[model samples]
Target: MELRQLHYFVKVAKKEHVTQAAEELHVAQSAVSRQIHQLEEELGVKLFVQKGRNLQLTPVGQLFLKRVEVILADLERSVIEIHEFLDPEKGEIRLGFPHSLGISLIPQVVAAFRKQHPNVKFRFKQGMYPTLIRDMIKGDIDLAFISPFPDEHEFVCGEVLLTEELYAILPPGHRFSEEESIKLRELEDETFVLFSEGYSLRPIVWEACQEAGFTPKIGFEGEETDTIRGLVAAGMGVSLLPEMALHYTGPLQPAKVRVTEPQVTRTIGLIRRTNEKLPLVAKVFHAFLLRYFQERIQESQ
Candidate 1:
């Protein structure tokens, strides 16, 4: 089968619905079906079994998928290498970052990159960690900045960019506001404001609270860090936030105090799929971010 046929087949396998796959591929459903059929015929096996409207991969299809995935990844890597050699500074780098980091870090990295490689373009998105990880695995995003590592076995390469201590964002007049740092155990009775589910920091907060001997009383759930801060400032609840998060000004100016009873820290990192080869532009950007952060860390001391 041709490489186009493999591409069509993989897309169908990913969606498990020909119509949906076709839409994602921006091609006609019939065209996708035809190519998948051609691939199956050429391979002398049934790749998918139709049950009502849903498609299921056959055993042979599953095995073929593994091989197809590797072949396609290698081919794509070669294409990236060739394209970069031909036009070093021109191409797209799709990246995702959590809102907290996106506000300041992304702009700095992008500015630095542009100063060196003006022709490069970036497609940036602010998303929760779960959504970012899903997009990265699907080959939709080249890189992501997320807190606390996920299963490292699944990704090809990743490096922790920065480690920041977690602190409680309290109302301006809260009892503990005057304290520089308070232990996690001291907040057992305090109402908590936090990011909604799917946020990378959620697990960190939960785990820290559990270690402190009580499940937090979640009073408010928000999508953005600033919103959480607003909730805390309004005395709706308190939140655990990263130190670096305080760098960005939010709508509400909550007290940024340290968590002391049992201090917790979160490491934010950049991750890419392990099996896929990163393009030259992505590699350069990754290196640049590391260097930039390293310099900042050194300068602080």
Candidate 2:
């Protein structure tokens, strides 16, 4: 039976009067009656009977009413869920970022976005660049803050949010600690604390060292930038890190020396799946981040 017929049947079942049901449904009485009759014919069951001046439901009619209620309720709920999904102001966003940005940038941006769109919720995934890119491609994350941008064609990159210079973090009493700016080649002989494989910064630093004429002599390997910084502070080795790493180094701040000869830096931007359009919430957040960074750039200038 058609949904219209089921709707008419439900109204009639609820009111127990065709005239009142039609009036409430804003349809003609004969139209409502015809729909109910068609539904009963299709089901091969009588749905109503006369009880003096009023109409009453038959036994089968009561059973059908219960099932119809559930079906109609589920349909209504589905419509509401679709509307919420399309709503820009009310939805969830799955966001991904590297552990370095997670220390400050991600939290600040999320807080600012929530201040205006309080109904929007966020699911955060913190990982290195490779992991974030992998998750984005797999549809596990909606959007991410990624550095140096993804080279694959499966992802689309947005405008640069931030460009941070790479610094050589040295121990407190190291020879290079007193220099105003150090060249990458100068650290060729020194032990280095490098990020583990799969981290985006490792390649950027490695390439810079290669251009400077020698590969870095790696002393230790760690995942998070903060841990690498800690290693530097403990005299384990020197490391190349983005400026953002310095902000969260706490009391054990390593000596930060700007890399000059080939001045290395990393550009961070938003990235998402190229195949699918972003959800309304993710689109809004993407725009919000672009605008936020643009304003920061203007203020800095």
- Identify the leading candidate in terms of TM-score: 1
* Span of ten consecutive residues with least summed lDDT in model 2: 73-82
Question: What's model 2's overall lDDT?
Answer: 0.85
Top lDDT hit: 2
Residue by residue across 66-119, what tens digits does model 1's lDDT show?
A: 788878866765776788889868866878888888756788788988999899
Regions more than 4 Å wrong, model 2 = 1-87
Against the true structure, what is every candidate's RMSD?
3.7, 16.0
- Where model 1 places Cα greater than 4 Å from the true spot, the runs are 91-100, 123-146, 149-159, 171-173, 177-180, 195-199, 210-213, 220-227, 230-235, 246-253, 270-278
Per-residue accuracy of model 2 over 223-263 as CA lDDT, tens digit each? 88778999999999998898877886367778988898889
Which pairs clash inside model 2?
none
